[model samples]
Target: MSAATATKTAIPPSGGGLSRESHPLAGTGTLLRFNLRRDRVRLPVWIGALFLGTLSTLSSTVSQYPEAEDRRSAAGSLDSPAGLAMTGPGHYLDDYNYGSMLSHQMLGFMAVLVGLMSVLIVARHTRTEEETGRAELVRATVVGRHAHLTAALVTAALANLALGLLIAVGVGGQGTEGVNWGGSLLYGAVHTMAGLVFAAVAAITVQISQYARGASGMALAVIGVAYALRAAGDVGNGVLSWLSPIGWAQRTYPYVDDRWWPVLLGLALAAVATVVAYRLSTLRDVGGSLRATRLGSPVASAALTRPIGFALRLHRGMLAGFGAGLLLMGVMYGSILGDAEEMIEDVDELREAVEKIGGATIAESFASTVMIVIAVVAAVYVVMATLRPQSEETAGRAEPLLATGLSRTCWVASHLAVAMGGGVAILFLTGLGFGISGAVATGDGGLFLDLLIAPLAYAPALWVTAGITVTLFGWLPRITAVAWIVPVYAFLVGYLGQILDFPDWLNNLSPFGHVAKLPAEAMEWTPALILTALAAALVALGLAGFRRRDLETK
Candidate 1:
């Protein structure tokens, strides 16, 4: 052959590269299996905890309000603007039966949980793989371009399906009044679709961000906005509600109206998002994002030079978000305080729940309840910040720093300090938020001061949560995720223990259970001091362990 013809034959044709070896979805099954195996323990815990907790809540609601009149009275309590904003639309209050009660009280919030799960799962399997550099290694094999994303979406979908199936079967088989087989199916579908939509949202976000945390943060922000839109819409005309995925699910009205069509909206949104994600994936190479990265300053800032300052810098974004979100929650909870007494007069279940929390009056008791929620939410931040060091270590970022002059204790303590201090600050901010709206509603400026101090009682508990995270990271780094149960369990029991008639032992097990119901009951220093001491001991134990163990380097 001629030299030119030989060279031409040696080069592959344009648009024909690797067509024989790889397709967009090649090796998707292999990746999916690997992702599932990695998540074996994690996914089961999510599914089992949500499944059992949901059923238990339903049964408790049914048992407590057996009579129709009782359910109606409880419904009456939820008919106000505060109820509509917190729960769902006013229509549920019309036919408020056992199933309707679950849909109204649970669906909107449950969608949030399911959506969060989807976002985390997608981000964990997709951008996290890229962030860890594992995707580049895997891509060098026969795996295709879109295999990681496809596998992640599949994993999220399967988990969501399992959760939805369990919920449907459990609720449908219960033989509860107003709950039928069809409505149960629709209920489960709502969860499944909502989760898929968020999973798709995460997929799109992963392509837009190079870091897993950034992608997940962006997706979570969407969840927050969706929830806010739903709340606003539910409180106003039903028009705004239609704009939110959460609202779409809740408006299904599961057993009350059994509007099955809204589930299709979620499915449609998920499909469109997935296609967009796939298209955007081609716009960038592996280990990068669609958006271009900007160059940073050549010199380090004075604050970033110190471990504590750097830790604060790393935590500030989340701190700001949590502060803003919690502040709004406080305002919403406090908005109803002025009318709480009059609205809850006939609702015996609510009256009992208020008494369970305990205060001089219904409004004050409700304020105390808000404090518990704020602390628990703040604990979530505490755990995340405490574990930041572990994530850095595993990612191989901490090894070089440790090899420098930085001691392990100092490095970890910096993050722990941020966690401890930020948690308490957000708690205070949340209280101030409550106080702001509450002061205006009731015309009592003193309420603001009382509210600020109310959250202080739980500061020790937040410290304890951070301590637990530190202990796990130091001694059992592989199992550090178990520390999340502290906040999750505390929030669950603290918020619902009264309504669910949870056993005293169950409630007592939460780190947050013992704090005095402040601004209502007299302040008790015993529990606060004990928790504080316990936190100190745990932190010392963790630091000692970290000093001895070798650093984990991914």
Candidate 2:
């Protein structure tokens, strides 16, 4: 070939059809089988957990308030300050049916979990392989650049499809006569579509980021923004909801409006996102991005000179983000509290229930409820932030830092400080914000004082998560995944206990289960102090382990 022609010639997409002989492309089918084999246990567990949890929740809700009036009373309680604070907008409570409540409380979480699964799986398949050098060997053969991405998405599609079917069966089997099967499928479809769209989104983000963490952060940021937009739209004017993918899914109003059309919209959006990802992939080189990373300092700064400083530097951004989010959530919930009493009038029986639950003014009940929710959400943040160190250790980044003059204790403590301190600050900020707003709307400045006490109630729970993280890092580094299991199990048990009729022993396992739902009820110091002590002991155990163990070899 002429030099000019040779310069312009491109490699065939799959090594010119010698896929297996020349590239991993030929092994796609084999990889598919292998991937399924590898995921057999993990996939089943994840899918089953989601399905069973959802089913249990649905069944419980249906059972708890069988009468329409009872449902209305439950809704009324939600319209209280505590209720609005804990849950989102109060309108969903008006329906007092299984479907509406599930949609309100469960739908967003479902989307988020599904979306996260999609992003993590797809990014692991594509970017993780590239980062670990596995993709290069596969690519050297005849594998298409897009092969891993496609496989990852194919896997997510299968997972989501099964998840959707499970949800349909779970909800439909409840024997709620005239239960909208179509709506259940619509809910599942929207969640599945969200997963697919985000899988594509993660693929595109991985191409743009140099590190898996960066890619994961990008995808998570998208999820956060989408959720925020939806919340803003749902609570406020709702014009902004149109901009969020999550909003589109929720607006499907699966059980309420049972709108089937929006599911199509979500699918269409996912298709477009996939196409865009493919086009973007064509423009980037393997393991590189169109966006370049900026150069670092020529010399190590004071912060970089120590592990604690490094941990702080790495985690501060996320901590700050969580703090801001908490504040805004507080403000939104507080602002809505003023309207709670008014909204409750739509259902007199529900209003009566609110009075019974709080046995006082509706405002008081709501304020108390809001505080509990703030604590719950802040606790979640605590777990996530505390566990950051484990992620670093597992990823091998902690090794270099440990080699540098950092002690194991200091290294672990830095992350713990961020998690515990950040959780306190975030929850406090939320309470403060909500109190201020509630006071303004209700013409009761004392509302601020009342709200202030709420987040403090959560401190013990937050600390527990921090200490658990530390303990896991020291003693069970490989199984630190269990750290999250604590929070997840606690959350499910506490929230679903009344609904699912679980045995007390099962419920007692969650440390958080002991936390008094504060503000709604008077503060109970015993549980709080106990949790705090337990957390401290756990941290000590973790520190002891850390002192004996070798720095992560990685």
Candidate 3:
């Protein structure tokens, strides 16, 4: 009657699809490509930083301690309980060679970073996708349920392997004294294994929680515990260290023992964890998790109704985590304050560099140097907090809240206030933590006040960092991540500039550079005031821009 529909309809998909269509990992390859594309810049930063850091450290060690006797003296300075807790087992000191020093001192810390990278990579791809509903959209097509997890793991695997190879090539290619090619290969293996183990840990955690942040929090907690266990275990009986993945990585003792079994153990654990994650994935629905979230109160509290209080609630977990983590980190840094003088006494270049960075007394100067590191870390929190509002907007949560009579200015200001206020609190905590530990280690009560006040000087610098994030978020939301450049450059210039022979103007480019090195010199409020004013101007500009622009459609 309609001319037989005029044209034939296209053939429908057959009931029996291709062999791989029904498989659990049908679209994993395609998903992996997407992940790689999405993380191109992010992945390269992680890989390159670790690689370059390792190379520079190795070069620094070689240049700083040339003769065998000098190396022995340097090793003796780091042989204390505090040193062992921070570095690794004292067994590596038996040889006390350059290779051993690099392995013992660097491996433990590097393993933590590698684990973190894997956790973030996996979380970003898997749980973050689910949180944003992208996973559901992609899954609506002919994709398997397990494809996302598989793709995320594959992404992590690629990053870790790339970093491992770089480390191997960097370490071995140098042909430095006391380091062999075989040992260099083992060094890379250590990082590779730790990364895979954490990637699997992330896979399992993502399935355990419905939220991306919760999943990431759990995975990061695992990393913290592993490092703590390694430290305590290394300080105690050697047996305890073996229980931790980080411990296993350290136990490889690249240049000293070069044990291959831990690598195998890591692989076995990765396989087991990955399988468990897959099994659990099958037990849950998309965008849901195995662990149920606790029910909330029916009525909102007085504070919960306000924008400031809501922003605080959203940021509480990160705030607490950063506070605790920084407190512990500050303690570890301070614990080594007692050895700072002895550690640098015999080395001319080293002593000059430390003095150049800080004060008259080596301990005071060392404390001052440590302040920059703490401030850099705190800035990380500032950047993250400042961007929280954008995250809410991108998630479609902010639009609804804004529609309910909350002015955009008030909403944005609330988050910014939290970012700035939280920065102050975190800085205080870190400084206080350093004060307590440094006081204990040196038996000088005055050191406590000196150290505590010293770190606060960087608060203005931190504010500048937050302001940059705000400015970028307002005018250039898509490129907001450029804000990280402020801190990264600060670290490179503030911490390593003297040694690297970086131009003095480069240091001035960072807000941290403008801040007077506290406790080393008297506190200069002029720079602080200038930085504060600059930050305010920047924030205002950003807010103006944000108000004029249309809200991002999510």
> How would you encode candidate 3's per-residue C-alpha lDDT over 1-554 as one tens digit per residue?
69888889977567866556567788999999999999989999989999999999999889888899988887787777777898998889999888999999999999999999999999999998998899999998878888999999999998999999889888999989889999999999889999999999999999999888889889999999999999988888788798899999888888898899989999999999999999999999999999987799999999899999999999998888888988888888787788888866765665776778767677888777767888998999999999998988888888889889998889998999999999889888888888899889888788899888888899899889988999999989999989989888899998888656678999999999998887788888899999999999999988988898888767
Tens digits of lDDT, candidate 2, 155-241: 778888888888887786676733578777776777787787777788779888877767877898899888777776666666877
Q: Among all windows of ten consecutive residues in candidate 3, which has the lowest summed lDDT?
A: 12-21
Best by lDDT: 3
lDDT of each: 0.88, 0.73, 0.88
Q: Where in model 3 is the C-alpha error above 4 Å?
A: 1-20, 347-349, 357-360, 499-501
Please give the lDDT score for candidate 1: 0.88
- What ranking emerges by lDDT with the best candidate at the front? 3, 1, 2
lDDT value, candidate 3, whole model: 0.88
Residues 1-554, model 1: lDDT tens digits: 67776554456657866663467788999999999999999899888888887898789888878899988888887787887888898888888889999999899889999998999999999898888888999999988999999999999999999999999999999999898999999999999999999999999999998888889889999999999899999888678889899999998889987898899988999999999999999999999998788787899899899999999988888888888988888888778888788676776665678887777677898788666778888888888889889878877899999999999999999999999999888888888888888888878888888877788789999999988889988898888989999988897788777655668888789879989888888888889899999999999999999998987776
Off by over 4 Å in 1: 1-20
Clashing pairs in 3: none
Every model's TM-score: 0.95, 0.82, 0.94
Cα deviation at 17, candidate 3, in Å, is: 10
Which segments of model 2 are wrong by more than 4 Å? 1-18, 21-27, 30-42, 68-106, 131-142, 232-239, 251-259, 341-361, 498-509, 514-527, 550-554
